[model samples]
Every structure is written in C-alpha cells, then in structure tokens.
Target: MTTTTAIGYENNLPTNDPASLIERTIDVPALGAHDLLVEVRAVSVNPVDVKLRAGAHAGGFRVLGFDAAGIVREVGDAVTLFAPGDEVFYAGSIDRPGTNQRLHGVDERIVGRKPRSLSFADAAALPLTAITAWETLFDRFALTPDDTGTLLVIGATGGVGSVMLQLAEALLPGVTVIATASDPERAAWVRELGAEHTVDHHGDLAAQVLSLAPGGVDWLFTAHSEGQIGLYSQIVRPFGQITAIDDGPRDIAPLKAKSITWHWKLMFTRPLHQTPDLIEQHRLLDTVAGLVDDSRLRTTTTRTLTPINAATLREAHELVETGRTLGKIVLHDGN
Candidate 1:
C-alpha cells in the first residue's frame, strides 16, 4: 500500500488554531488519464484556502492548498506536456485534492514548466497570484502592452496586488500605475514592485487617485473591494474598465451610469467549470515562467518555512487571516 503524509482538516473550523489542522497518512489515489503525480516540494497559502476552510467538507478530511512547485514523479498515459522528472509549478483545481500533501495528482493541462532560475519555494508563490493577475489584466480587461493608459491599483501590497503591479509594469509599456498601500512599509514594497506612485488605501482613495490622475484612471484593479465599489466607479474614467478578484456580493450599480466596464476574475473558473479552455492556464503559467526566467518579473515570496507540516500550515493560515501580509508565504519540504 502506498501512503503519503498530508495535513488536513476533518471539519470546518472558524479559526486557524493549531488544532484545526492535523497530520495524517493517507493512501495515494490512482491517477486519472490526464493526471500528473507531483512530488510536492513547496506550497503557498492563499485567501481561498481560508475561505474554503469555513465550509470544508464534514465527511472526510479536506486538504487545502492551491499553489505548488515540485517535480513530476509520474504522469498519466494521456499526458503530453509533462513527464516523469520534469520540474513544474501549478495552481491545482478547486474540485480536486490540493497540493498540501507530500504527493498530489493534478491535470497536465493546468500545469507549467517551472522557471529554471527559481527554487521550489519561490516558484510556489507565483502560480495562484500570477494566474489571477494575468487573467484579470489580459482576459478580463483586454489590456495589451501597447495600450497607453493609466491604472489605479487598490490594496497594492497583498498577494494579488503585488503580482498585478509587477505584471502591469512589465506588460503594459506606456501605462502609469498608481497603487494604494496603507503603511510606509507596504507602500515601499509596491514601489519596489514597479508601482509608479503610491497612495494610502486607508486615506481618501478617490481623492488621492484623483490627485494623481485628475481625468480619472483608464483601468482600476482592486485587491480588496468590500466597500469601495463606489469609489472605484468614481475614480475610473467613463467607458474605462475595472477588474477585481475579491469574493463577496458587491453592488456594481454605481458604474452603470458611466457605462464603465467591470469584470470579476476568479482564477479557478476554468478548472471549476471544466471549461474547454482549461489548457489556457497551462499556457498562461508557461508564459509567466518564461517572463520570470528572462528577468522581466520576480517571485513575490516574502517568507518561507522549512519542511511542510500541520503546525506551520496553521501559522501560515493565521498570517493570511490577518489580511495584512505582504507578497506571499511559502512552505518548503524537499524530496
């Protein structure tokens, strides 16, 4: 019998207490035709991990992790993009067991060749955030590097914001980025990531953005949009676009009058719905890896823990729950 070590929760827990996550030895399931058995080396926690824990399945343990970087130990007969011994990075599907275990099985259509220059932990931090940022800017907003415009990024120090700011700077040639970070430390971090100017998200958002671009920004990307849809509508130019990844019901009526375009980017949509374009995730991550290897973009890993385990996962979850983390936190467990 083949078994692997994994950390999981038996039921939903309100808090990220150490007891909420537990270690277990579980059987490695048989792979599907398109599955790639990944020897998980490093993993990163995201907001969705926390949100999913709130409603975790009750019948059995639920493993929660999305971003992973590792080597492919085995590949299904139908797989073509990757094979055994290939280094890879991916954000696994929401419908399948995640990459929190020592071994995980994911579809080849959604995985990418890992950047040659990055360590497993650094590569682990890129997938989920990179996919979200890439999809939001290119797919949702129809933006191209040649497009000349101004972009306003709110909550610019979080995982998605950190990557979005960099991607915008690298991909959009003639655009200006006005990012919002609450404190000096976060402000400096975003600036380092290529934000042209920084404003305080805790202060007057619209006023600050207006001060920078009095005519209004051509595009707006909000990492945290709980009560700021109205403000986004105010600061974005008429017929301009707005994109967001925050979960929750938001009243988007404010932008209607101005005929402003708004889009919600859920990185899991392709996997969740089993869309025919699911392979696009593979293509996107591959492109991102090339950019990273070319020194056009860098990993956003702000912290890393040696060896993956339940206790460390609990600590990582606690930090993610604080809603104050900069960039990404990764846990590395080498093979």
Candidate 2:
C-alpha cells in the first residue's frame, strides 16, 4: 500500500500566475501489478512542464514534472526489478500525474537505480537529458560506440547538449566533437564537457562549421532553435544525419539538396504512446547510471532551489524561458 500526498494545481491554468499552483493533498491509488511507489526527493524543471501548465486543456488539476530522483517506498506484487527502499531515478510518463508531489506511482519498466555516487539533486537532472542524447545518437542516427567521425552539437551548453557532448566523448572514441555556444562562458563550459572544438552560434553557422570541418560534419544534433534546420543541412556531409528535438515551422527542403537525412527525436514519444519498446527507456537509464557511478558520465545540474513550491518553481521557469540557462534547474524538498 502507498499513501498519497502531493502538491499540485487544482485546475488547468498558467503556473506563472501565483494562484495556479494550489497546494493540496490527494490520495494516490494503490500500485498496479507493475508499478512502483516512489517518494520523490528532488525534481527538475524543463520546457515541457512550462508549456503544459500554460496550455489549454481539460479543466482538471494535473501534475507537471517529468524528471525525478527518489526512494522506492513500495512495489507491486509482480515487480522484480525493484523493491521497497531502493533508490531510483526516472522521467515519468507525460500521460500521468508527475513527480512534483511528495510521492509518485511510476512504472518500473522506465525507472533505473540511482547512481551510487550522485546526490538526488544531480540524479534528477540526468534522466530526461540522458535519454534524449542516447536515443538521438544510437537509435536515430545509428552512431555506433566505435564510430569515428566529426560530430556537431548545436546549443552545446543546454540540458541535452551538455549530456550529449559527454556521451559522444565517452561512447564514441576518437570522434571529434564540434559544439556551438554563442557566448564565451558557454563555449568554455562545452569545451570542459569534452567538445573538441567550439563555435559561436550568433554568427554565420554554416561558415563557422565549414571553417572547422572543410568536408562537412558526419552528424549534427540540434538542441536549440528549430529555425536552423536549413542551416544545419547546408553544413552536414552528404548522407549525413541531422537530428532535432525542438519543433517549429521551418522549411526542410534544404536537406534534399545535400541528400542529408533529417531525424526527429522526441524523448517522450515512447512513454507517451506506450510503444512496444517502452522498456528501452529502462535499459538506457540503467546504463547511464552505471556510467555515472563509474565516473564516466557527469550530471548537468547547474542550479538548485530549496523547498519546492509555486514561487520557486516559477523562478525556475523564468530561468528556462530566458533562453540562457547553461544546464538544468532543480527544485527539491516539499515546503
């Protein structure tokens, strides 16, 4: 049995408003045959949370967190991967109430044991970014661990880009990484994370990339503005794959001229739709944990806020919306 206690809104509305997040307690139903009861210790905010909170939807209070690191308080009858008291981390399904509360019931199939070396705040930032970067490299672009080629990452100091740069260095040995950071501080940050080269995104992207790799990059991952889709195509090698996680109105015709392949990576697609490969999220997260524990992959949490509440969450949202966050912003502990 799992006790239900949470803090969330009462109706669909913008969280930017002071009254939008009405803290309240509610009953969490008993765990299903395959669910695990989680006592959330820390949670991270992403662009998705802000969008969902402000969007028009059915008039009902919905929880809006995706990334969490916590302790397992209970387990379903059929659960084998985890047990009560196990420390874990996960990005819960978007279709369900999120981890913004004191406790959350999540499917064990998409959760991983927390890294032994990381604090809950650090672990909380890894699930969403790690999954996005891993899937983009291995699943979408089909880049192998041994692939030795030049890779380009746009918005290199962002949540996903920070992790993607580290993963590329750790997994793809001998591969050269070119990362884009518009400012000097971000460029230094990306280089510290393992980028072989860095360029300013504020200038001509195609020209800067061409100057670094005269032939063109073998793979390009865009974590920033979707408006640069055409620009990416112009700098990618023939038959090279370009992957993006952001969505916006843009012309993709430029890719056709270079015979460049375009790939869209939505990290939530598998969990949101309950696809047959939903278990892959579990496997990938576990792998990430092992890497972290072994001192291979690094956490990307750049800022932390104490006491989870509407005010603190709103501040975190403002940081993300500013479009200048280097890594992730996390909120921990219930007030």
For TM-score, the strongest prediction is 1
Q: 38-94, model 2: which lDDT tens digit per residue?
A: 999999998877667666462466777899999998899989999899999999987
How much RMSD separates candidate 2 from the native structure? 2.0
Candidate 2: which stretches are off by over 4 Å? Answer: 1-3, 10-16, 56-58
For residue 20, give model 2's deviation from the true position in Å. Answer: 3.4
Worst lDDT run of 10 residues, candidate 1, spans: 11-20
Backbone collision count in every prediction?
Answer: 0, 0
Residue 190 local lDDT, model 1 = 91
- Tens-place lDDT digits, model 1, residues 25-136: 9988679999999999999999899878766564688888999999999889899999899999999998888889988999999999999999999999999999999998
Task: For each candidate, give its TM-score against the true structure.
Answer: 0.96, 0.94
What lDDT score belongs to each candidate, Candidate 1 first?
0.88, 0.85
